[model samples]
Target: MDLPALPKPITVDLSRAALIVVDMQNDFCAEGGWLHSIGVDLSPLASAIEALETLVPAVRSAEVPIIWLNWGNRPDQANIPPGLARVYDPDGRGEGIGATMANGSKVLTKGSWGAELISALTAAPNDLHVDKYRMSGFWDTALDSILRNLRVDTLFLSGINSDQCVYSTLTDAASLGYDVVLVDGASATTSPQYCHEATLYNTRQCYGFSTTARDLQTAVSAYPDTCKERS
Candidate 1:
């Protein structure tokens, strides 16, 4: 199928395509979660949820795989480097990853409420789930192996912190030779507006093309009749 995207329109084979939703988890997106508990405004990240609501089902209906890549750190956090640990708790406060939030959930720890996907989004039983420790999901995660097993060559990226985790994963996917598409509406960031714009610009200029959720939906809707035939 031909997807209308920035930098140019590109054709994608549904059989070799998958959708990766990154860090749409509660820690980064929900109120009372990690970022919110630390006083970061969540309004910017919330925009991606609405877009994902429509885009997810549309992509699923077309038989495309939905891969949820979220932060699910070890409880001990032994694998976390000092530099990364300082990102969340620069002053040696106890309010970093693995810290308990006001709601009684440990921030981003595996099996913690804060590490789970937002309640608004549902993961289908057969969908893929990957736990990531770093901004780049490819590092120390099974994401790349799973994509390879599925024989996916094209990835549709969406999720929170467009300038950070989402961008990091996209960059790695491109470096690994996978065709990537950043779904603008389905991805957002808590960073400044300029940061988000820079991410989009960099994606189109260096990494891969980008398209709106609506355009992606339109493209997927055009291919329903061929879903079973493709994969």
Candidate 2:
């Protein structure tokens, strides 16, 4: 199927493609979550949820696999390096990853509410889930292995913090030789407008193509009969 994307339209085999949603978990998108507890605005991330609500079902209908990649850290924080830890808690405060929130959920810890997907998004039973410790989902995660097992060569990327996690994962996907497409509406960042703009610019210029969720939905809808069952 040919997808309408910026810089140029690209062709993709639906059976060999998958959608990767990064960092759309509670700690990033939900109110009273980690980023919210840090006083970051939650409004910008809402657009991503809104877009995914429609796009996810559409892509699923097209028989494309859905992979939810989220930050699910170990409770012990043993694997977390000091540099990464400092980025979150510069003062060595207890508010960073693994810290218990007011509601009693440990921030971004595995099996914690903060690391789970937000209530608004529903992950199907057969969909894949990967726990990532770093901004790039491919870093020290089973994401690459799962994609290989799925026989997916093309990846459609979405989710929160477009300028950070989303971009990081997208670039790594490219480096790993996967065809990448950044679904614009389905991804967003809490950073300034310029950061989001630069992400789009760099994605088109350096990493991969960029397109709206609506365009991808349309592309999938157009070739409904052409989609084959996933392996």
Candidate 3:
């Protein structure tokens, strides 16, 4: 069968491009933390992380920064919305996500869990972690300053809740004038179809472009010398 045509070719300035990984915590991606009851699965989360694993070396080789974006918040039920309560409330005992993934990396927490990255994908030495309070990564977060400090001109976006957090991040990133690439497969929502469609729609409309983690890995390998910032 013929595959769909690839999107327009876009190159991230290795020295100025950064990978912004949104919430990949157990509550969001694992089998039983919070939203799993709603059908959130670990398959895509693992797949995305695996893709990052394959692409990290490439990013490191090119000197581009790999950032891990997480969420952390006070242990208060009032913080969570009524609709999201059944999934992430204190009753759910959701604080383990961040603690589970804590390691040698810059940590950023948002909400109560601080938008924790999954335990399966811990941060590396060169990784920068940022905690966000709102939907967008740039909203009162150190993300913008860090990007500016790194002279980053492009952002490779991925993570949980494709229709919410990921979408919000992409929108903000685009408005900020940074070249953005949304990894459709690297992200998953409570609903797989919704996540997929959201990624496509947002990429084709608001974001600069979209691709899968595998394809991005291929792109990185093609330009092996393009992302060597980690080592």
Candidate 4:
């Protein structure tokens, strides 16, 4: 099947844009948790981290705030949908993957693994982190308030599991009127087709555009004065 062609080269207004990293957690990306149960390879975790290495410095130099949205679930299934909670033992305490995320960025835990950010990725002091109970980052989470506080109008999204959490958060962000960007190569899924298909369908259609980290970097380098013009 032919994949969608890249959209036109676009530059966002840096002064009003922010980078939103979604549920790139160990449970989904590493050897433990639900995703591994289905035989998914998390080597993409490394790819995502590499993408961040190329993109983060550029976004940071542009003064775009980096936001990490992680999960913090409760022992009881009270916070999540009953159907989701019932899939696993509510009281079970399982260790995910091998290590915790060392990204020095501000960290937020959603669902249960409040301190872990997928066991990989770089962290920086200025990064913003928030914990979410549900799939949507805006649902009962500090994400909205943080974005508002930063005066962010554009959200550049990256992270794991394209069909579930990432897709859910992007849809929610679009409905709220924020300009969105999906860093295409910075995300992955247990199913490669799932990731690619989700981005082609919903990205830019309901939310904003889908771009690669490299393309964004180049645009930023070529148009460093973006804040002076419309995105």
Could you give candidate 3's per-residue lDDT for residues 156-221 as a string of tens digits?
A: 887777777888888888898987878766766655676668577757775678877777766665
| Per-structure clash totals for the candidates | 0, 0, 33, 18
TM-score of 3: 0.74
Candidate 3, which segments miss by more than 4 Å at Cα?
1-6, 37-46, 76-116, 224-231
Question: Local distance difference test, per candidate?
Answer: 0.91, 0.89, 0.64, 0.66
Error of 3 at 44 (Å): 4.7
Rank by lDDT, highest first. 1, 2, 4, 3
lDDT of 4 at 181: 74
Give every collision pair in model 2. none
Local lDDT at 167 for model 1: 97
Q: Candidate 2: deviation at residue 87, Å?
A: 3.2
For candidate 2, the 10 contiguous residues with the lowest summed lDDT are 222-231
Scored by Cα lDDT, where does model 3 land? Answer: 0.64
Two-way lDDT contest, 3 vs 4, winner: 4
What is the C-alpha lDDT profile of model 1 across 47-155, one tens digit per residue?
7899898889889988899999999999999999877876668897988878888889998999999999998999999899999999999999999999999999999
Cα RMSD for candidate 4? 6.2
Tens-place lDDT digits, model 4, residues 117-176: 655576589888887777789998889888988888888888866666777888899888
